[model samples]
Target: MPIPMNAEPNDGCEGAVKGAGENIVAVSPAALSPDDEVALRRAIGELRRESLAMRLTALIGRQIGFIGLMVPEPIAETINKTAESALRSAMGIALASLGDRSTRDRRGLHKSVATMAGAAGGAFGLAGLPIELPFTTTVMLRSIADIAKSEGEDLSDPDVALACLEVFALGSSGAANPIERGGALEAGYFALRSLLAKSVSQAARHLLDRGLSNQASPLLVRFIAQVSARFGVVVSQKLAAQSVPLIGAASGAAINYAFVDHFQTLARGHFTMRRLERIYGIVMVRAEFERLARQI
Candidate 1:
């Protein structure tokens, strides 16, 4: 389904808004001249390339960060391999779904794409150092959910997906506008509630174990709580300030984090791989959202 042009922002941010308006005015998807399309395609290609490089860098950074703590090489290796493999598989499935010949065969494929697109959008916004990675990841997921719904998918049953996306949109938007921060916070709190509601009890237990177990060091829990809290604040403020539709950029950021965090946590044994994979299906929906976001 075509992404709604109205969802895009128009406050002179970049060519995305301007181009989107122009395209809307022209009333032709083919209104993009060959030259324009070529340029857009090239830019998108570059963005995709850069996103891949960034993803690799983030992966390596995570590996190195864990290793710096003197983690066992075998455990680190296993974590890195699993995270990389999962990310690659998810991306592959998402891209393929875009071109699936059979519309009927596209349900699962489409969802996967939407999820990843949200992730990619978030990744695009948070590529710099001192990584605000989690915020961007959430935005991506939220964007995916929004996009999927536009395409006629009902995502209400999947609380994890909803929570991740809600937090992302809220956080990213809050970052952009402080007054809106409260909304982002509310959305984030709700998302957390949703995640807990849908989350398997065992998976929650594992997260607590890896994060807050007696055997686990206090430093780890402290770090997780700190980061999570910061994210929560940013997202909540964003949601409070504006409607969800106004926070597309933030939504993209949130989705990106959701996928990355999900995989990383799974690899680190902070969550059950099987349960996480079930949640990972949201990635597909995110990818499609990203594609549509770009078009918009």
Candidate 2:
């Protein structure tokens, strides 16, 4: 089916993606050029690759088991703490001085850095995560920022940086369809965005107005907490996979490549959606996004 030109959710366009309990924003569809429609279709494909959990499973060829059995259960707690701290530190120092915002994204360089970090972590098995995870996360944040700029995001804008952090949260889920098997919209892309919208806005506002002097302010803290919760899920999975017998530096490097590649895919899709939203308004673009998602 060809993509819809007019996706009016409230006006009863077919397959309009309404959040389970959220209010739909009322906005008219803009006249999207043919190029814009094609771009929207491609973005939907990338978003559908939301299943990082499955991707890791496929790449490693091993089923990740329960936390306690794979490694010490305390590692789970450590993973969450590490995720939060890494996000905090990355926000403070990662891309602020990237320099030359107009240049093309250096995707290969970022992947190489992540692979090296992963090898270092993999060498010590689970023992290395506390040290390696944060460093690798910071590198992934830089890559995400690079993709955001490639998609035309202004890196100086606090909201865009917050969106960069959002990739971790979004990449943790594995849902392909917005409407799940039992019709729950609990973990879909649009649903997740709806959930995070308030904290994201508040955090962005606080950063824009007061700067990052006090990173522990209520709004920013809440945003980091929320993102860290989801990010911990993926980290846990990666840890479990790493717990597999004989996972040396080589396997670790491969897994890390897949890890960074997964987020890069999500980042590309997300920022592409944002770019289209800037042009056609989110409501129309989102409605059309769901329409295409259903068709696939």
Candidate 3:
């Protein structure tokens, strides 16, 4: 069942979560029921996988050497620049077109569209990247919006639209080892949100205040740039994978399938976290997320 977006907090639990056999720990009042805890645990497990980089590495690295080595300096630059531009357009135009339409999401439809685009791009190889990436990125954004809506987000809210955009950044962050960067809180899902929180808020404010006419405004650019920085890493990996010798349209389609699928997985986890955050406050959800990550 779809989780309710605006669930009311139940009375019983207050200020602390019950642990093993009556052991209690201080936490936010947004305590989960037994069932909700199970769902939260499953979502946290998915979030912790860090699968995109590893999946790409395994799939592509086996055929070619390390995925990173396949790309030349020029192509890498092109990938990064293309990613930035495509994301900017997605935020301005792609997501702007999305609205809360039906109860069920059209994930399959969006993925098929992206796959075909990838096939077309793959036929031309790297030369087709500039055109291919933007279209596919826009499709991905649409799929993400569908996921967000399924998770009970109000797409009419500029903040939620930006949150859909944030999924791109989240996918890249998951590929990295959050623990390696110092502290758990310093790097994982929460940290990434914290980092983008300012830009997202500012950009959302700009959209609300001025609309899409000033998409080039400094506030929006900063937000897009921040998202693009992390997003570019995955895009580079994708380019390197597609660069392997004789990777024709069919292979390109396969890679593109994975590409959209990766973000879709992250979107589900991300929006699920957001859904839980709405139910239980962020503090409680985050604390539980950390605890569950350790247990898992």
Residue 59 of model 3, lDDT score: 60
User: Which lDDT value does model 1 have at 295?
Assistant: 59
Residue pairs in collision within model 2? none
lDDT of 3 at 144: 90
lDDT of each: 0.30, 0.73, 0.72
- All candidates' TM-scores? 0.21, 0.84, 0.83
Would you list the rank order by TM-score, best first?
2, 3, 1
Residue-level lDDT of model 2, residues 177-246, one tens digit each, is: 4434344346678778888887876786687688788898999999999999888777777777777777
Q: Name the runs in model 3 displaced over 4 angstroms.
A: 1-30, 61-65, 174-183, 247-250
lDDT of 3 by residue, 86-186 (tens): 99888777766765556467899999999898777866767888898889899999889888888788876677878888888877764544333333666
| Residue-level lDDT for 163 in candidate 3 | 85
Q: On a 0 to 1 TM-score scale, where does candidate 1 land against the true structure?
A: 0.21
Sort by lDDT, top down from the best = 2, 3, 1
Off by over 4 Å in 2: 1-29, 65-73, 98-100, 174-186
lDDT (tens digit, per residue) of candidate 1 on 1-296: 12221122222121121221233221222133455334334432322232221232253333222222353555334433332332223222332233212233232343355445544433433222112323333333333443343334333322222222223222222212212122232332223333433222223233334422331334333323333443333322222222223345554444344333332221121112112212222232223223433553
